[model samples]
Target: MWKVVVVALAGLVLAGVGGVALAYPSLAATTCPGCYGLTELSPGVHVEDGLSPAQRERVGEVADQAARRVTAFYGGRRSSPGLLVCLTEACYRRIGGGQERGVAVLNRSVMLSPRGLDPVIASHEMSHVELHARLASSAEVPQWFDEGLAVVVSGDPRYLAPESAPDRCLVAPSGPLPVTLEEWLRTASADPATYARSACQVSRWLGENGGRAGLLGLVTRLNAGEPFSALVRTR
Candidate 1:
């Protein structure tokens, strides 16, 4: 089965949406070929999918939380709903979606194939959406911050069985070693289980020292072109 995975930025493949490479401008709602069904959640925010009621509700909750989180981070909320979740690959295909596992347009919704939509996975992917939006533009986010925070927001902070988490969240090859920021940026994608653990490890470190705010600060600084060596020591 086809599952989305993160590709290098140079390729324009969405990080989580199934891996079909496309130019960033092509991801807009009107332009997107795969427009699934749409359901308004809050005032402007709506989720687009063909999921059952229960599943739809799950999408709404995550989208709501993502909106709130982004507003808190960037000091403003989306006037128009900036969230989208697709359940079936058909929905993704309608938008001319790529093979990348998922894609988040900073300041907009996220698009992913419906083949794997667990509660944790949904939250995790939406966090990427929130991060993307809060940054106001995609260029502001780094892969480490984008992926790590996705792992943190996916659910209550705790580990689960391998079968329970998304496959891509699993640990990467270098996971046995003490992972550093450098390693996080350099490493390729992993299964959900490994991704979750890696996020946890980074989240744990952030919490032990600086909490989410601290982590955000560190990320922001790095994104501004500060060296990891400097931010890592300060954080």
Candidate 2:
């Protein structure tokens, strides 16, 4: 079993990630020969050939819907045209050369598992894109918070189980909230509760102040070079 690796960045966030860049190989370059073809079902969505036209349309619909949903909640600063999404196991694995369920690149390119193009996954990946669009390349975002927000917004049920309060280290009174956002996320693993904890913390903060607007404000502050942990410091 592959442990998920997530990274939250200012302009390019990735789940099950290694790093940045949208340099996927062409569809014809997949390691699995003759296993993939590309189709443009919508202005900005490219799907692999295994899906029928109807399935491709549905995938595009899901992608568009997810983009709208995430941008609406996180703000519309996302200016990218759209994205490239893979829909086959061979294509997903071959494009990014990874076994992680999903991958999002800086150029708005996404490699999704065959069974992973549903609304939840669609929304989750788009969340990264929208948030990334709003972020600066140097912003400080915790991995847990990044993944949590995506999961909650996507309505992904697995991590929906409410997480108790965040760790004391995250919320307890401290001398200037420790700046561990980068290191924590860089090393985070596939702990289901970690996502829930992030969701809980961010959701709680938003709930306490403003909802979507609050989230947008946080993005703005982050873009301005303020660490998210500092801005949301409980004490």
Candidate 3:
């Protein structure tokens, strides 16, 4: 069985499987072979593919719904217009499968397994793509923040709890508040509970503080090299 290999970055960790060495650029480049969308999102990221016509339509529906949610959440920001959706098992395998899903922001893409997710759940994964693109590429939003927002945006309340937290989100407490970003990335994996709580907190904070507009500001601040400590402090 293939295992997960996680790559860490500015407090975010992406899960990959096997020694397959799926180059990020190649995997990111896996658009519809010959088709690429030329919009603000440019070369819209491929989600999953290799499905029957019905499945393809379903994937497209899921993608469209997710796009709406992202736009609603960050209407003020410039988001990629479309997301290439795929649903074939083979397509999942080509990218990797140990992890439930993967999102590549550089190429403005997202990939997921549609085995058991409902449209809402799949939309959640799509939200991750939007978040990845909207947030400052260099911001230290923290893994919990990233995964948490994805879950919250999906509209699933379960993700607000630790036990129900996503597999990749990890967190630990060094003192009293919660595990710092440094601790989260340094740890082997995030603690499920801490991650959930942090995500919920951030989501609520963004909503109450400035709604989507505030969230955009936070992401912009992070991308501009503002201290996460200052930005996240509101949360």
Candidate 4:
């Protein structure tokens, strides 16, 4: 029953991830009983588990596997300084990763638990990290685009639903999807079904177009600071 969700910097905006609080407690304001620095397991993959050395190793193995999956997903097109996967309650709370965001990727790192670490979750956050690496700014990316692409690239099962059309690549649980991407971001996350809908729509878009090639072109344009509206016309 523990389906994974990834909260991208958009806090699900990027990976269809959602729900925890927005504020991050100062690092100094919080500390784990057995605080430890993140350990580098594989290239650009890090893990910090306060439980035991054996647990740390286990988490590291999972992270390494996820990292490889992510790299392969993009066909080795992207990377970052590193990725941090933590398994400390204190760290989770401080970073805002609870039921709302069990697996989230923030500006500083990616937060995860052994219970939450899966290929889908890991790859979703990895997509966000790589996108940010490309965008490289506070440059806004539409929530639907972010979350949808994460779900698509992560190969999450929820995205298997075959939506009808590429033009239909938009959703809102209520009141008609807002007029603007910004407005959609403000409203879409409120609905619990947001992630699944987004994944379906995005998958449809990728399929209707030219698969990864089309996706990469769109990503490149977005990184160049193109607006999401330019790619998908919504009236």
TM-score of each: 0.55, 0.69, 0.62, 0.65
Angstrom error at residue 136, model 2 = 2.2
| Overall lDDT per candidate, in order of appearance | 0.51, 0.60, 0.52, 0.57
Q: Which stretches of candidate 3 lie over 4 Å from their true place?
A: 1-50, 81-86, 105-107, 136-138, 161-191
RMSD of 3: 11.3
TM-score attained by model 3: 0.62
Which runs in model 2 stand beyond 4 Å of their true positions?
A: 1-36, 75-77, 161-190
How far does residue 138 in candidate 4 sit from its true spot (Å)?
A: 7.4
Native-referenced Cα lDDT, model 4: 0.57
Give per-residue CA lDDT, model 3, range 110-185, as digits (tens): 5555462355555565666667666655766666566667666665555453434443223323333334557654
RMSD of every candidate to native, in Å, equals 11.4, 11.5, 11.3, 12.3
Residue 114 lDDT, candidate 3, scale 0-100: 47
Give me candidate 4's TM-score against the actual structure: 0.65
lDDT at 123, model 4: 69
lDDT per residue for candidate 2 within 1-235, as digits (tens), equals 1223222342243421223223545322322223345556666666776677787777877777777767676656465535556666676665653665665665255556777777777778667766776778898676556676787677666656433434212322222222365644444453335555565565666667787878878878888888765787543
> Whose TM-score is higher: candidate 2's or candidate 3's?
2
In model 4, the Cα lDDT at residue 181 comes to 56
**Higher-TM-score candidate of 1 and 3:** 3
Best by lDDT: 2
Q: Which regions of candidate 1 fall more than 4 Å away from where they truly are?
A: 1-26, 30-58, 65-81, 98-102, 116-119, 132-142, 156-194, 219-225, 233-235
Clashes of each: 42, 0, 11, 1
Model 3, C-alpha of 133: deviation from truth (Å): 3.1
